[model samples]
Target chain A: MNGEIAAILAMDGIASGAIYVLIGLGLVLIFAVTRVIFVPFGDIAAFTALSLASLETGGRPGTVGLVAVLAILATAVEATALVRNRALHRLPRALLFYLVLPLVPAAAVWFAAGTTLSMPLRIVLSLALVLPIAPLLDRIVFRPIADASVLLLLTVAVALHFALSGLGLMFFGPEGVRTKPLTDTVFDVAGLIVNGQTLLILAASIAFCGLLFLYFEFTIQGKALRATAVNRIGARLVGIRPTSTGTIAYLLASLLAGISGVLIAPVTTIFYDSGFLLGLKAFVGAIIGAMVSYPVTALGAVMVGLLESYTSFWLSAYKEVLVFGLLIPVLLWRSLSFSGTEEEEAEE
Target chain B: MKNSIVAAVVAASLGIATAAQAEITVGFVTSQSGPGSSIGVLYDRGMKAAVEYASSVGAEKVKLIQLDDGSDPSAATRNARKLVEENKVDLLIGTATAASTSAMVAVANELKVPMIAISPISVAANEAGDRWAIVMPQPPSLMVKIVVDRMKRDGVKQFAYIGFSDAWGDLVYNGAQKPAEADGLKILTNERYARTDTSVTGQVLKMMATKPEAVLLGGSATQGALPPLALAERGYKGPLYGTPALLNTDFIRVGGKAVEGVQVSAGPVIVAEQLPDSHFSKKISMDFRAAYQKANGMPTSDGFSAYSFDAWLVFLDAAKRAMATGAKPGTPEFRVALKNAIFSTKDLVGTHAIYNFKPSDSYGVDDRALVMVRLVGGQWKYAP
Candidate 1:
């Protein structure tokens, strides 16, 4: 209730909210680009943290095995499609993209296992290990039904989240882990000490947002993704392949999740099942954006963080109820504001 | 005719002797794959160690039929039913969480089999006329009383409370109320967080604003470390206390420097090596450690797992008495005998506590079941 305590709580809220923003951005981006909700975004984030924890302990991360299995599955699916289409010439490209590229990080992690690596190296390796998961999951689970109804895709994505969580338990052994803080510095401003980790998290969130803006505004690939997000069929008509754009969306979104994972891991314990709740909280932010606007989503995510922090201060037991309760009013508002939008056309 | 009657009596006696040596099947249900899996795996490991120990020590062959409930209560029910009706187990033990354990309680009663519950269940669950379940772990009230007693001794008037927002949390919070009141202590705050909550900064901040002399956490396993870590981050240095649920290696590993000096009330088995030589639990606790190391390939490092070991000890004792009644292992008569024998368990020594159960009692341990422990240098040191 006091000014110093309020300031500290704000710092905590913003720091955690920044993580939600990162995850929300990924959720909104993926939802726009591929009509899939990408429920497993938080799982990827959690896996990144677990990977870093494994690296810190000088053990082989389970991500290597997970990515390898996904890569093989994706490759087999692609190879079978190629043979069915009698496009033998495209086989080599398929093998490289599906099989070889995904395995590189797994191999790196395999080689890095049990040897002491610097923290920066471990973070990079963790990010790389998680990068292939979302994209390859797209190939194996989402590609065949790429044009399916949004509801169906959402169900599949949710199921994939559970499966990955179960796999996470198998690999991580049910113990929660927290890595060492990225920085130990603290700042004193007006009689309040602010943790350096909070500053780093805010900085990372802002930097990623700025970078994403630049990529979307300046880069051709990013524009292609935006075009697909705007109109999948129209983008395809103009020569942008939705499949490639979808893959790009997954990769970029996963990078956001990966970064958020690394940022949040030191602050709190991350477990195999921890991702679902985080992702769901961010989804509340995404819903506020109507699954469309990035800035609105980011703002809503921060509001959620602030709301959560304040609510917990006032009513700790009902904190989750209050945080999740925001969605009802937001959904009501979204429905009122976006009533005239036409639904997507179903393609055979 | 007399000679034929003598032969028939001899054959029936041989049949009864063979039945006494038959494999006694005991079903184990535990959460192996869900949110509860962290604690569930500990129970599973302890049960494995118990099976090995029983085989080596007892003359009777003990067959353990294990099933994973995946932390689901309904699944626990199904597994318990399968174990009893199909496998025809003589006794039941399992499912780590209270809800799932309670789910198996009904099955035990309806199926006429005795169950040794490893988790604390509500009083209503055991209030049935034909109750067949008895708890292994110390009741939360008894454990919380020790914490409250220590608070009284330390001259602490009020303390902040943070715990999981589940039944376990409610159990601890409610358990502390009467004891805390009697000890002239006041509870300042009641903050709760979920097991999967990534941060408890909000809850911690709220609790710290009250500025109590100490903090008592009702959380268990790895999640128990969250509040302490939050408190440490804010540099709130004060005495911390918790129930036996906090006495685990994962709690220490995750809490790290923050949890040091925090005292917890736990089963004496946790600090077995630190106990006096004459303590009743000391020998069995040491035996449990050896069996655990042999079976799990590591030393026992948790308090939850030992409950399973103790449950096994109780079952072995009761099953021996049940067999003395000349009932076949798979028959209904043997289940009744086992149930009666379990209810009559008296003065049986186990790793955690000396066993004593009554027909109407759900929890059997007294004050001897608990020990106050403190974390120093990342190890639980016996503080009492």
Candidate 2:
């Protein structure tokens, strides 16, 4: 490919990579705070996009504005619930609690928005509806199960997966539904063709990463969350309520996931099962990041996305085989590396 | 309490009286769920409507025992057994998927019951050894020939093939290739993708690289949407063609403006507007649409339902002929007489085509009617 074509392909790859980064960030956040992999994170994304796409009237307000408003409201409600519970000390437990609570409201909003709206509106509505859902999930299913075994928690996650998948099927039906892009502008700058929506997604990823980094570094709560993540007992002894910090972490992760859904929906139409594949990809990205370090995880997601895109472009039919084949070896190496560290940490 | 007792007695007596009267039972099986449910819905609606119509015209009431096979071939076999041995159905009609149809055909031949396949006609051809199996809809191969012949007539020389990487896709490609090759039309490229794979950009990119004059898509509307969308996105403005399976609203919903100018070979049911105005054609178009929409929330597209309706008409006409021949109204005699009458059918105008069945050619190739339709304003408009 010439420089111009190469630049165009690179731009497209980056734009696609941005979506994976956002989704990966959400997975990392949930895993970082609660130490539980939220497998249904992609379902939240798919549902949110579906809701947003289903909410469009002939000339009604756009999905972004509606989603922003809903996100603010959900954040406020979840924050209040955390305060009332006085269980702010156990940040991880609280985070799990908050993540499970929002599914009901999310489903309700999805149903209400589904009947009247156009494809774009439904997608936006779905995104807006799911913003609070992650925190709500933390409050309900995960919080009570915090003291349970890791296997039990994993089982719960699997159960949640089934529940979410079933609920999606019940609501959306078996066949996949398509959504229109939020914008159609494809910009040609320096021989690089970038879709307007993809550019926005990239911008959003950068903005989110920057904002999150700032929050974790500068804010008191951010430090508390970090301390809690590092050592929950030590953080509790130091007067940092780790539980509340975990809740905040989960809420932030869910917000990122909801936004990711909104962004990805425009590029790839949201379907009920779209999340399973995305969740698997996000999980792989998180694993590549060592399930810690937001920047590393986000970068990992981008790399994986690029790998996928390039492989797909180059190999066409066997792209999946190439990408997945690469994943197995990487995962085995990571497992071996992590096992050594985990043994050292235990001995220390 | 007294009224309830009297009503129960009346129901029991009526049931006994109906049981006393000689009755013929027909079992119908089709998909009620899964990805292919839309076709199943159409089949169910068409079967029910035809049966009701037949009942209204007949002296003896015909009972339809229905079962949902969920589009699973193995489940279809189980359902076939249930309909045959358990339900003791006199005749069996079923299965929307090719695999399911094939499985049921085996079961029907084993059980020695005449089976009418309501789905694609490809399965029937695959199991041509089964003498009892009759495909109501003309085979995809025939449909492919129709499309290629039409394209040839229109002076198209070069073509591309983009189809689902499944049995349905293979059937269309296999059928279209021989004719296209015979007509001196060069096959520019052929690409295939799994139905579950949402993205078709790579396939479209590969196909466009070959630069064919026209493209033939062999998949359902949802699967069909991706290639056209990718083609449009990549600025490939060649003529797009598809199979009857693409004649669905979902394809337009997904493909948007890209669906425009794309032509496909559709069954007579979808291209009913092109057929000459006749009582049979108009009634089939109007009544089938209304009844299908009423039974199922969504409107029915082209499927076995049209053939099922035709099958019902053929069955009734045969029954009337049998009665005319002084055959007894009892089950065995009625079945034998009906089978003989059906075999003797000639020049009978039905919904799909003119039926003329013979013992030598059970499916009656003359009944096959195909038309090319173009997507105009998100609706299938017949292309002459």
User: Against the unseen true structure, what C-alpha lDDT does each candidate score?
Assistant: 0.89, 0.69
Which residue runs does candidate 1 get wrong by more than 4 Å?
A: A345-348, B1-23, B29-41, B48-75, B123-128, B293-297, B324-328
- Per-residue lDDT of A32 in model 1: 95
lDDT of 2 at A232: 62
Candidate 2 vs. true structure, TM-score: 0.78
lDDT of 1 by residue, A80-145 (tens): 999999999999999999999999989999998999999999999999999999999999999999
Candidate 1 chain B: worst 10 consecutive residues by lDDT?
Answer: B122-131
Q: What is the Cα-based lDDT of residue B335 in candidate 1?
A: 87
My TM-score estimates for the predictions, one after another, are 0.93, 0.78
Cα lDDT of model 2 by residue, B201-281, tens digit: 556656666778888888775657877877787788878877777777778887888889788776667766566675346
Docking class of 1: medium
DockQ of each: 0.49, 0.20
* Tens-digit lDDT track of model 1 for B313-349: 8888888888888887888888889889988999999
i-RMS, every candidate? 2.3, 3.5
